[model samples]
Target: MKRDPDFPLVRNLVITLFATNGHLIDMGNRLVRPAGLTTAWWQVMGALGYAPAPLTVAQIARNMGLTRQGVQRVVDLLAARGYVALEPNPHHQRARLVALTAHGRAALEAAEGAAAAVDQRIIERIGTERLATALAVLGEMRDLILEELAQSATPSNDPTLSIENEE
Candidate 1:
């Protein structure tokens, strides 16, 4: 079989990225689960660790680029496991804020050691310096492209006008 040169290259790129990320998460989860954690848990922990301030589901979702419901489920599980605490949101009385509990902090600390092991393995598999540079470049490009797409997709001042991708 022959393939067209312009055969939806973007689709192939998206699939490759997702598959690689899923495998990486699998490795992380392997390291975390033994310490009573999941890949989802790490996402929340990383966000809170990045900024200790309590964040609402919506806020964390935006920051993590995940759906609000997706984060809510993770928060619910974390709370049930006593790894996280649910607090009233000061900014929005109706919204609940998610914060890491003492247990969560301890768990995260333990997980960090495991994370280092995973990091070392990955670095050895893929050159440490090369992977670091590739990750930075990919992140920057993803952000820039998303920003451009968002801007272009926004409705124009004129009614009944909006830019979009056409097949």
Candidate 2:
């Protein structure tokens, strides 16, 4: 079978993206550790901090591009640590809204402060123009992938694109 000419390039891009994500997470964990928070904890708290109001676990998961169960675990841990509070959701009875408490906000702020310094170092090393270009490329890639996902049908709808066949 003739391979699609772009397959190799796309595969390389995906491999690089995955590796980059792992590296970023490791760096994020280190940066947030001083605030007694892991990357996952900081991410959830940051989402809450930036939001106009409280959000449900599902909402947070969707926004973060994570699984609901994974986000739920993080929310539970945050609540147990007094970093967040779960309140009654007027919009949904079962799905309570999660909000950052004062403690959570402080921790998130500390994490951001730490990250700001690292961000500056990165900018110094990579330069603003190069970083901006990289950001634009990544944003475009993400948008295109999201569009493809939205339009995708089930595997049964396209056997040629099935997991087994793709592999």
**TM-score of every prediction relative to native:** 0.75, 0.81
Q: Which has the greatest TM-score? A: 2
Task: List runs of model 1 lying over 4 Å from the truth.
Answer: 1-13, 124-128, 152-167
Candidate 2 structure lDDT: 0.89
For model 1, how many clashes?
0
lDDT of 2 by residue, 55-155 (tens): 99888986788877899899999999999999999877788999999999999999999999889999999999999999999889888877897689577
Tell me the lDDT of candidate 1. Answer: 0.80
Model 2 pairs in collision: none
Backbone atom clashes (below 3 Å) for every candidate? 0, 0
lDDT of 1 by residue, 17-96 (tens): 89999997898799889889998888887787677698887778778888777988998998999988989876676667
Candidate 1 RMSD to the correct structure: 6.8
